[model samples]
Target: MTKMIFLNLPVKDLATATAFYEAIGCVKNEQFSNENASSMVWSETITFQLLQHGYYQTFTTKPTADAHATSGMLIALSRDSREEVDAMVEAAARSGGQADVREPQDLGFMYLRSFADPDGHDFEPAYMDMGSVG
Candidate 1:
């Protein structure tokens, strides 16, 4: 069986969050989406579950942290090339997200850029040359 990952996020506005995910190349899985939540497929094995704050609370007793003020995690996505990393960031910025929350990093073999969604969920899109890694 193939292992799949589901990233569940608490969002203030479901519609806005859903649109932002779609702008960044995720396709909506209507079979799993509804008014309070949206299932966004990033890849065959990766899906993002965007839930309204109230709905999200039902799944956890912990109070939702304000992503704009505090970051609990950073989601990293691998890209095929440096250009792809830049493009993702660009798409995010154009779609109600912030691009380059921090300075981009470039090593001899790896390149990475960071961004945040409208609610400030952080993401790092990176590219690495396998041949250059030693």
Candidate 2:
């Protein structure tokens, strides 16, 4: 069975990416954080690999996300509560990320907010009360 998940992404600056994830409360894996890439551990099962542009090209044939344009994908993290979702989004902005959405949404049962990293990679933080997952 698959037990681990690796989310590999490209970033413009390794240091900035590292700082952004750290500000969002992720502890980096030192073993994988180096000149070319860094691993941000979100949980026991989730890891985000932020690679330098040159290094990322070694693995994928597709072009990298344009820092000034829209991304083809959006990364999302699930939070325990609406407050947690807001905190993460706020933290991202404080750490050089931008709010992908103008404001957080309150849908009675679910709350969501979006943010984009310095390189323009999109992300979202969502919270759904266990009783509301329908």
Instruction: Pick the TM-score winner.
Output: 1
Score candidate 2 by TM-score against the native: 0.91
| Deviation (Å) of 63 in candidate 1 | 0.3
- Clashes in model 2: which pairs? none
For each candidate in turn, give its C-alpha RMSD to the true structure in angstroms: 0.6, 1.6
Reference-based TM-score of each model: 0.98, 0.91
Q: Could you tell me how far off, in angstroms, the CA of residue 129 lies in candidate 1 after the best superposition?
A: 0.3
For residue 101, model 1's alpha carbon misses the true position, in angstroms, by: 0.4
Each prediction's total of clashing residue pairs, residues at least 3 apart in sequence or on different chains, is: 0, 0
Q: Model 1: per-residue lDDT, tens digit, 13-130?
A: 9999999999998999999999989999999999999999999999998999999999899999999999999999999999999999999999979999999998999999999999
The residue pairs that clash in candidate 1, if any, are none
Q: What lDDT tens digits, residue by residue, belong to model 2 across residues 37-121?
A: 9999999899999999999999988887685576587778999988898899889999999975557778888889998888887
